[model samples]
Target: MDLQDQLKNLFPDHEPEESTDKIDAKPSYWLQDDPIICKYEKRKGKPITILEGYNGADSDLKKLAKDLKTFLGVGGSVKKETIIIQGDFRDKIMAFLKDNGFTVKRVGG
Candidate 1:
């Protein structure tokens, strides 16, 4: 079963009810521009990929990361809302973001 199905099975009374758009769905004053940040760090002297700047809920970020990982054919994770893949893909990610209509600016060196 899927995660949502599993959750519903665990808590039958709390089954999800499809409703109107969430308050956050609108362009609000509190929302940050959603963009994927790509960075490389050392992990025990090994290079590691860190994709950050995902500003959303846990499940939503996780789902986005999962889809991205599948498309990139790389192993990655959704950590604290950051999508950490296994390699540096700043150019690739920037292209993806642009194709999706998200304005992007590469921040770090």
Candidate 2:
């Protein structure tokens, strides 16, 4: 018999309790009302995209940065409260953030 069968034999009248761990495991992040700024700039003659104004946990911001970099197939880093992406992908990043329920404000060309 399997583990379930053994368990049933050991306690035939036992009723399993609903697990709340699954519900708690769901990822959640703070949603800010103010728009997140997406700015484009040239650093050391290389184009870069900067994202700032996130008023959430640093871990959440880091996760966001990772997701963005992975989705865009680009390199990036999270410094304190800012995300620096190694490209001029302002439009794409903005759309992605908007889709993820973030208000994005485009800054600088």
TM-score top scorer: 2
What TM-score against the true fold does each predicted structure earn?
A: 0.58, 0.74
Model 2 stretches astray by more than 4 angstroms: 1-28
Candidate 1 structure quality by residue, lDDT tens digits, 20-80: 7667532222225765566777677765567677676776667666766776788887767
lDDT of 2: 0.90
Q: Candidate 2 clash total?
A: 0
TM-score of 2: 0.74
How much lDDT does each candidate structure score? 0.66, 0.90
77 in model 1: Cα distance from truth in Å? 0.6
lDDT of 2 by residue, 1-109 (tens): 8998999999999988987665543245678999999999999999999999999998899998898998899999999799999989999999888878899999875
For model 1, the superposed segments whose C-alpha errors exceed 4 Å read 1-35
